[model samples]
Target: MDLSSSTVVENTNDFRATSIPTTINGLRFYHELDEWQQDNHFIRSGYVKGTNSYKSSFNSLFYIHNETGNIYSHLLPSLVIAGSLVYYLKFQLPLYESHLQVWEWINFLQFGFAATFCLAMSSIFHCIKSHSHSVARFGNQLDYFGIIILITCSLISIMVFAYHREPKFKYGFSCLFLVLGSICTFLTLDPKFSTSVYRPIRSTMFILFGLSGVVPIVSAVNTYGLEVTKRKAGLNWLIWEGVLYISGAVLYAMRVPERFSHVEQDQASLLNNPMVGKFDIWGHSHQIFHVLVVIAAFCHWKGLVQCYHTMHQDMLA
Candidate 1:
């Protein structure tokens, strides 16, 4: 116990207990030597940080955090759908010998309608699904309306195609019927039914929208019997369209694998979230809806092509 040695030992002990600096909320914190850096791993490195700012909305395309992933998951396929329509117009439509002067215009309108419907549906789905009770309630209702609008637009596009091919038919009748159906559906979506209490009403409206296709489809098929290749192609198009539609409906209504594993899927990555991410993009219910829509559009295009071909052959005869 020499005095100088004792003094040196005390200083070394004090040094061992000195604190190290850390940061949180832009404020520096200090911890004793033993505790120093114990929580450092909890501090997120800037390199691995997730986007928290609304400014990185574009990041939704690549990142995996809540809304960003879901938003882009819906958007990418929409772009594909738009591109497919453009390809049809530029490359496919001109190949057909259509006489309708406004056929191109109608196709453009249909493309616009489909694109808008997709965007609206995506907005509604992402906006409401993760929100609070009030938000979920109101947002879900709006989402439902968006879905209805999408269905209506698709049905209208089908009728438009039919009208383009058979201008003799009264376009006004189809327009009036569509408008009336839309108004009726909107009115009948009683707020009471808006709750899960009457899911059947919501489902019925969807069915009505789908069933409306029967008018033009039957007219086209009956007028141009299966002897005509164009008629056969039209039938094939309708069949594929129906398949995509039914598959999508089943995936959506059942919620599939995600339904059984809600907790695991409630928060997911693009690699995960089978229902909303994987199946939802090109495979999801809405994507399937979009695919069916495109199939229907292509079917309409095929019918138009067949009509032009048949009419040209008839003139030659």
Candidate 2:
């Protein structure tokens, strides 16, 4: 049989009509016999209309079809990072008292939490919204909010590093810039740009947010000279961060080996199959992008640590 015929047969055999009583939103509805087979029963309804297996094909992690799993993957790490930062502040901040003021510490902690929240929401949007058009719309908003959160975090870092000399000024400026950047990012949430045609613009917006670090970076280099070991360390972190981000972006845009071998990658191929199980989760373009973002954040943290060490040593001297 041809591919289409095989698909029809497989779909027919995979899904059979049954009077499975289902409840959605407190309303009783007869489960349709033409439901498509998916990893997650929760996601099998709504936009997905077909006669096939509705049961999840992969592990529990793979149950939720669409990009929800992808979003969760990012979210789980974000929470861990946020929790670690909180612990650091609560227990470790005192040891670094000379380097950070109470208010500065608070600001950093708050910023970290907010960033985590945004990332979690973004992941949820990708995972659950694909079930319905309205849900997808809302998910898009959450995704944008997540981006804003990242921008807010970057702005906070910039302020922390920028006005290290003036605690009060740094606090105010950081809050102001973060709010402003968030507002701007929120405004750009036009549905038109959500399509593939606007991929470049969307990608550029994210890159712009990431690149905003250059301002504080330049300030650090100019004020604290490249001769300082701390400055060199910050530069090194920045370089590596840029490399990871750029590489991820290139992979996402190019679509790489999969694009070159479309026939080999159809559904089963690592290139096109959004749900090829664990390998796709860890190695896919979006996963790579998520990893890159985390790396960039860590690099920034390194830069901050270097700055603090250098300044502290200078003071001691």
TM-score of 2: 0.66
| Candidate 1 accuracy as lDDT | 0.47
lDDT of 1 by residue, 17-75 (tens): 23211222111221221221122211111111222333333333343332433455455
Query: TM-scores of all models?
Result: 0.55, 0.66
Least lDDT summed over 10 consecutive residues: which range in candidate 1?
39-48
lDDT of 1 at 89: 63
Per-residue lDDT of candidate 2, residues 207-316 (tens digit)? 66667656555655576665653353356776777677667667655544323322222222433334322232234455566667777767766665665555555656
Clashing pairs in 1: 279-283, 279-284, 280-284
Which stretch of 10 consecutive residues in model 2 shows the poorest summed lDDT? Answer: 21-30
Compared with the true structure, all predictions reach lDDT values of 0.47, 0.54
- Identify the leading candidate in terms of TM-score: 2
Q: How many residue pairs clash in each candidate?
A: 3, 6
